[model samples]
Target: MFLVALIFIIISYGMVDSLRADYAEKWQLDFQDPATPVMEGIINLHHDLWFFLILIAVFVLWILLRTLWFFDRSRGTVPSKVVHGTVLEIVWTIAPSFILLAIAIPSFALLYSMEESTDPAITLKAIGHQWYWSYEYSDYTTDSESLAFDSYMLPESELKEGQLRLLEVDNRIFLPTHTHLRVLITSSDVLHSWAVPSLGVKVDACPGRLNQASIFLKREGIFYGQCSEICGVNHGFMPIVIEAVPLKEYVSWVSSQIQI
Candidate 1:
């Protein structure tokens, strides 16, 4: 019974670790859990590239080892008069070309998919300031007043139990799952970046220029990100949190916000 309980505990801990990827973890070696299709594709492409990289690395290592073994100084082998082999050179060149072609095809395909424009059901505008983010729901307005709010990181004193220290925010961007959403990012002052790894979005927020990206949430969770670009002294304090909820819950939240 004791052994069974220990095994169960280990398995449970591993499962929890794998599922908790919305926020940054200590000593994290992999990407955060994917909450959108774009992130899923990004992870898949990364794995595919790793496969090719491993193959190339192994082949190079084998060639190096073979050469070292065959050309050892102790063996005193006679040197061949041939300077180079055309067949060998051609094989190395043509092999890389084919490998490059294989890599390029999928890379281009993923890039196109990422840049493809789509009609969005909801559009949100994010404006970055010195140390905080301002969001506006451009799609919904009442009496010329649109739903907008500023998100600031919660200080350590204000954080509750189980809340992340630098990652928690007073207000989080709430959106509906399985909905096509467009986010327009720009800066009110210096350059900033609106990045959320789970959603696979990293758009530069530049002054006088607006950048747009598409997001389609596939799950419900709180995803966290930080300003990737160095904007000011408090850039590290500016964090982003997004909460994906069901359609009905999102609508209710929206209604409540508009009322406020």
Candidate 2:
């Protein structure tokens, strides 16, 4: 009976792990699995900061509890008349500065990496509308036409089996794995942010001004995101989907689009 129960538990855990694919789950507290190096860095930094946070929280709680227990009136203990110690003041101040320094070093390194430019194999231009997203593959053009398409969220009524509601889009941006990609973003109407948690990408879309970000997908998967900024009434309807495929598959897709 014990062996059977252990096998059942293992199977159940595998089922739950398989269901979590590049999208947010219900009541999820942890981040989705990272698909890019940038996201992996972000998660690592988060874990490092959490270690410090937990240590600080526990130390503060211990101080509070110890004070309450020793200085309580019920304990008949006398409070010390001494107010402040210079050593304690300096220790607290200097210790926090060191902690801030430690946190800032890695943060600045990650920020610099995110802004670093690379010789991209593909350039994708994303334009934000009031309630939708449009993508253009500017690098691959057919003399007079470029590969461009508008992506809109699929309504619940039209959703197919196993499709995630509100996260599914009619058109998804196709990218190639292990290739450096440059994404240029701007807005036609209002402010919108293109954000994908698993990819560690979130850039603001401002009218008349262009913003760029670099992406290098480490794996092939379907990642989902929504408009992070509030633009208008239908802001929630704008969803972003990216389908990463192998290099050969991506070439085929580009050829197909050009032929069309």
Q: Model 1, range 1-260, lDDT digits (tens) per residue?
A: 99999778767655442244388788999998899888898999899989999999999999999888988989997668999999999999999999899889988988888888789999999999999999999888999988999999999999755678898789999999999999999999999999999999999999999899999999888899999999989999999999888999999999999988
Q: Candidate 2 lDDT, tens digit per residue, 76-114?
A: 999989898999999999999999999999999999998
lDDT of 2 at 78: 96
Tell me the lDDT of model 2 at 128: 98
Candidate 1 stretches greater than 4 Å from native: 1-21
In candidate 2 the C-alpha lDDT for residue 201 amounts to 96
| Model 1 TM-score (2 dp) | 0.91
C-alpha lDDT (0 to 100) for residue 27 of candidate 2: 100
For each candidate, what is the lDDT?
0.90, 0.91
Off by over 4 Å in 2: 1-20
Q: Give the per-residue Cα lDDT of candidate 2 at 164.
A: 80
In order, what is each prediction's RMSD in angstroms?
A: 3.6, 3.7
